[model samples]
Target: MTYPSYRNYVREPVIKVAGTGPARSGTEVWAELDRAGRSRSDRPLIVVDCYPGVDLSDLRKVAERHLPDYQVIDVEDAAALPVAEIDAKIADNLTDDRVFGVLGRQTVDDFYDPDALRQVRDQVAGRTTPVVLVGWGALLVGADGGQPAGTGDAVVVLADMPRWEIQQRQRRGAPNWRCDNGAEDNLRKIKRGYFVEWRAADRHKKHRLFDAMDYLLDTTRLAEEAVLITRDSFQAGLTAAAAGPFRLVPFFDPGVWGGNWMSEVIGLPPSDTNYAWCFDGVPEEESLLLDVAGTIVEIPAIDLVLQRPVELLGERTYARFGAEFPIRFDFLDTMDGGNLSLQVHPLTDYIQETFGIPYTQDESYYLLDAEPDAKVYLGVRDDVEPADMMAALRRAEAGAEPFDAEKYINVFDVAKHDHVLIPAGTVHCSGRNSMVLEISATPYIFTFKMWDWGRLGLDGRPRPVHLDHAERNIQWDRRTDWVTQNLVDQVQRTGAGDGWVEERTGLHELEFIEVRRTWFTGPVEHDTAGTVLVLNLVEGAEAVIESPTGAFEPYLVHYAETFIVPASVGRFTVRPSEAAVGQELATLKAYVRGTERAPVGRPVHDTKEPGLS
Candidate 1:
């Protein structure tokens, strides 16, 4: 886990305030404008830009009602004109004295024309009237499609919406150009627009708008909230000394093996099918919540790592993984659902060679809840032949005989609190009627599914299978005997104190992660040891985590909630809330290991109670 000390990676300082709250109502828009000192005679032009799937017709109606004097212009109305011509029209009209303000609406697609955007930026610069240009692409592509220096003056507000909301909007036939055509075409356009184009645009580039944002409006909740961004708030976030503990807005997605566990437990409306995965702590795809004053601002989590790597990830981890979070925690729900596809992940070297990533995903499944018949398909049976396994999979793919998966894969009966190690190149799946917390490396989406049961995906198509890739990476040596000896954690009592006991559960050669479970009736002291730690209150109703030094506020974490302990915090304590102190509390802790030592916070033998030995 130790790496060579090198400070080669340094990100330029960029500060922006991104906030999330309920979708804004018309009245809220008027309130925000009034707060910004805007009036009817201000001749303000508000440009409401949105993501492809978002409908802004209602927003425009509200603006018109509030500012009856301003002329409202829908950019979609000019869709027939070439992008350059539209830019020309905007430039010509920018200087009109009679016009109170212009309201421009467009999607991220329009911003792809860099020259047109630059022209619009130039027009807005010369005009004394306040212009509010809104669009999802504005923050991402900026004015010149490079940096956002030209957008420094305008009041930039990012309408923060969760991906789930966007999907829901799409399903409801939101007013998009593609939606008018047909559902099939609309779905295809959405997939290509968000997944393919937007992802590529955000992969490596820093969105300059984030650093220049004046205010962030969260539209993800029922009541919209706006937070003003400042450099001090941004700095506090990196150090884990922010006003409060931050949790990214979780997003759920359906899969072929989706289940209703999340819907039932989290009180989500029942989906058409089931919800399979929840992106709880995937920093690449998650956003951080920053409470500025009383308002909550949402920003992409990666910005914290890039801006203050040492503060967020610690010096050692930042040096080793750079800006990467290195660890991820996501949910795999199979409760009242089907089993996951049988799959393997590539080894570190193989992933680097093929996908150009620094690390591979070596994950472990920690069963949070399970039915009596819950099982996990792991490793390969001792007597199974590799060639025969391949033959069976191919036959299943060909629609001949179904693959007798259990004959080759080891199906282990699982129960709650069971931790199953699934390192790279290990075949595995979470069986039906179980909820698993997948703790692993951050490089997701590299799964090589070897076989899936004879079932179609939510889209009614066969899921892609990567037999060739899986075959090359599958460690045949990690059969039944090896899996039993190493993959399954050997629980050992590591520490005990008054009303508390800690047990080391995981930490094997297959991965750098180490996990421990603590059961306590009172508070437990812990140390970060210059490495970030991810903790989940698996069994407790609620707990408060506080730094002994009083550098940060007491952070409350609810049951099944995940939070991080920054390396800078050094030492902290986890205590159950007053109502739950009399009852036992159980928590699972995981962190990367760099040296040989006892579990963190282990009491010294001399400090142990009289009867503890």
Candidate 2:
């Protein structure tokens, strides 16, 4: 069984509060401290530990305003020594009693010896004076890897910021004294420190810090909002944490064939060029929002899957996929843009052997909007030779000649609402002038580009191509006839209700995912049936999703917004919103097949359906 990343595991914290960013005014900090009954003149020593590049000058000023006689100590000023010497210093400091009620600032870095941290925890125990430890890795040391530090009433707060903002600040020449390497290297170092080295430390300790957190300060947006985390709130279900329908924080990146649709529609800040992809619902890289007492707190989406695997994905799905959310929803904006690179994803065993991931990407494109004459490059010509095709791609890569993509690849005209299956090993790319909502398996970032249209990327460099990898995985038989017959979905009416109709549009042998479209003017009832369902309002203004027994909170969704219906929520209803009461609604829903599941394979012209057993 594949284990999930550390972020997946979560437990109810003693107390938790979330706010936007770490940057705050001294007055704000003073007010918060005052409210928490920590404003006494003889307040315990506040340890202010901070992540690299986080400025805490304002916080210090706030503390001093409340306690005029308080002293502030920067731990970095202490002499660095061997573990033995550090242990001695810690012992001496603990018994001194002279520094009681003094605030100490600790900078926990990758180089800090873990043993020294344990010593600090031991020294601080049984102290009458309060202590605050602040820093990115402060919890790792302060809590002794999540054990109670035995410092009475000690409150731990996390001042959090997004990785992108940190990188952006670094690019602007912000001081990152911890690294001697240049900006790019420093960025990689920070990522590795968090996602790799730090995560590999004591697992129990890692889990404890988050469980012990009293507050989380998020400085990702302007006007920082603080969220209070209480056990009552966490266990109260999704309604309490999410408040209502929520969207993950989306991220955009430019590509070789980047498009302008996202740049124009999303109003993203000016970048090198148009943005090409929007990670809308790829939970592994996306963050969800928890609105606690009116403050929005961001947490990795995987946390929900881990916290409620059976509830969110149903028992069967949880058993099959573990904590991994099997479905991925993202946007490919090729509108008013160039064609994507000719690419193919690895088959199941190949991805497992090459990348160690359990599943390969089995993707499909649901054209949301497409300009007249827009096309999709799919499969290869029936008469084309594999050797000749590889030779042409190589020639194009070398700039020897422009590759005529349509000469070997079959190009199909695309229209709005067309659903096309792009199982692994099928050669495919979105042609210019189309907005595609790509739904697929969760394994992303494994595309092997067989060819690019001989163009430079946004960085003004020739994009890399992976011909050998593509050749190994590509299904040579999925040519023109196979593409036209099997890759295209067949729409069939499945069910209907008063003023409503449902149709199954996609279900093939290549993958076990199923897609259905629903058109309704009134209410429509559905069941999760021990599987999670992802639905997108493709053709309506808005809708309200409610659990009949009030088992789940009512969710309000807008057009193009993607939402999940947890398996625990078994049966639910979707009705047009008040504004849309008289109008028709068209929604596209996707889920893994409950039975007759097929192993990942290449798309082929097969007429027989796979057996359930």
Candidate 3:
């Protein structure tokens, strides 16, 4: 049962706080609100606006227990639009497609009728007793877009949680905002959140709730306890994180083709099935834990991306992507499980014209572990007719027969450190028993799956196969011979220093990301070169990332964990830790090419060999 499992994976990575020694908790949050109210008018307004998916039951019960004299009002009951009307307004964004939808532009204001909002505001303003306003879109009643009903005697508090947690709740039957979709499919629920609700909520939160809030509450804990921190401390933590190395809190999930690798290595709950994916370096759905004194405050990782875009993503990257983290690192485990779906990604022009996404997903698979007999299905046979292949796929889709993949696909044997370069429009998938370190652009959901091997998903339904999208995007030129020459581990040594050497790995000329692998027995120096760096410890037991001039604290990393170095950190160094003083450690790092030349020129192969039987 011995394997390459690093059981030291951290479930909750945290950053230290500087300005706020200790944050408010349990009863202290209520006491702080009481004190603030005392300083205001005789009847003060306490506006508590929440992000989507926050539970208001605990908030209501706590408010009633502590502030017994105040009148608590839920804004949804007071001013929210009817469910049918809300659906009508968001219909264009939530298209008929179950898994894909248009980007929504509506704000929180669009969810409430004007007359209902005006009535609620007047009622709150004329109240004689102290009032506690709460729930999603609660800030829409404020006079100047974020203030408290045109008054100076009010305190605003924002209750928020990360989107990953929201998805988890959705899987457990939590409905989306203002909808009665409690029993909807989880995939559809996620699509609604991704395209419609999250987009609108993020816009509302950034402009209306980020700075103007007097107190920010962290409601991400399982016990449902609230961790309240001053707005000043929250901003300070984000600024500090952007100036050094940090890891986003990684979240794992199970799938039909999941595996036991992460379950054993990361020490996940045994009650659940195998872990299929780990989003370790994604800023969009992950959260950042800030350690303030002894309490931990969990906020969405996107907060840092929004608040300190230039510092985190660098000036050059910010100008291009505009507040988006362009690179993503994740784990795809098929160890002792099933192969991933046979798939192809859309080309850049196709994605732009059809999906409205500016960039396509061009990815590279760097294997961290693989069985001896493991293989990856890549490219097509050297002489398959496009019309014939399309007809076979349609027949397979109709259950005429199981797709004879071995007859048409090229399977390459994989080893521990092999890097596979897969540009967009190339057919590819990792076969069973391979732990993949998937590095790619951040549009992670743009995959168009072609076949699922006639297997139903974990939900007991047939998985969605995009045969039409796949037929139009797959390239016939990527046959066996050309792929064997261009797509496999095309590594070349770039430089060598004392006890250290660096190699350039190919991600194809069409991709925008550049990757470099460094192996060191001593110290290795690295400069950000004005863009951010996302790296994973692909080899050795442990390593330390340090600052050359003592600029920031030394960060410790383990074997399979991924961490990010912000562009604000100009120079840094990496060396083996004390535990692995003699071991030669290796790290695989990826960053935007930002005016750098591609590692290799485009492939110029056009062979017209006969088809394989």
Residue-level lDDT tens digits of model 3 in 241-300: 998999999988888788887877777887456788999999999999998877889999
Candidate 1 local lDDT, residue 65: 65
Residue-pair clashes per candidate, as listed?
16, 20, 0
lDDT of the structure predicted as candidate 3: 0.83
TM-scores of the candidates in the order shown: 0.75, 0.75, 0.94
lDDT of 2: 0.61
Q: What does each candidate score in C-alpha RMSD? A: 10.6, 11.0, 5.8
Alpha-carbon lDDT, every model? 0.63, 0.61, 0.83
Model 1 residue-pair collision total: 16
User: Which segments of candidate 1 are over 4 A away from where they belong?
Assistant: 1-25, 28-111, 126-130, 137-152, 167-207, 221-246, 251-275, 286-309, 595-599, 602-613
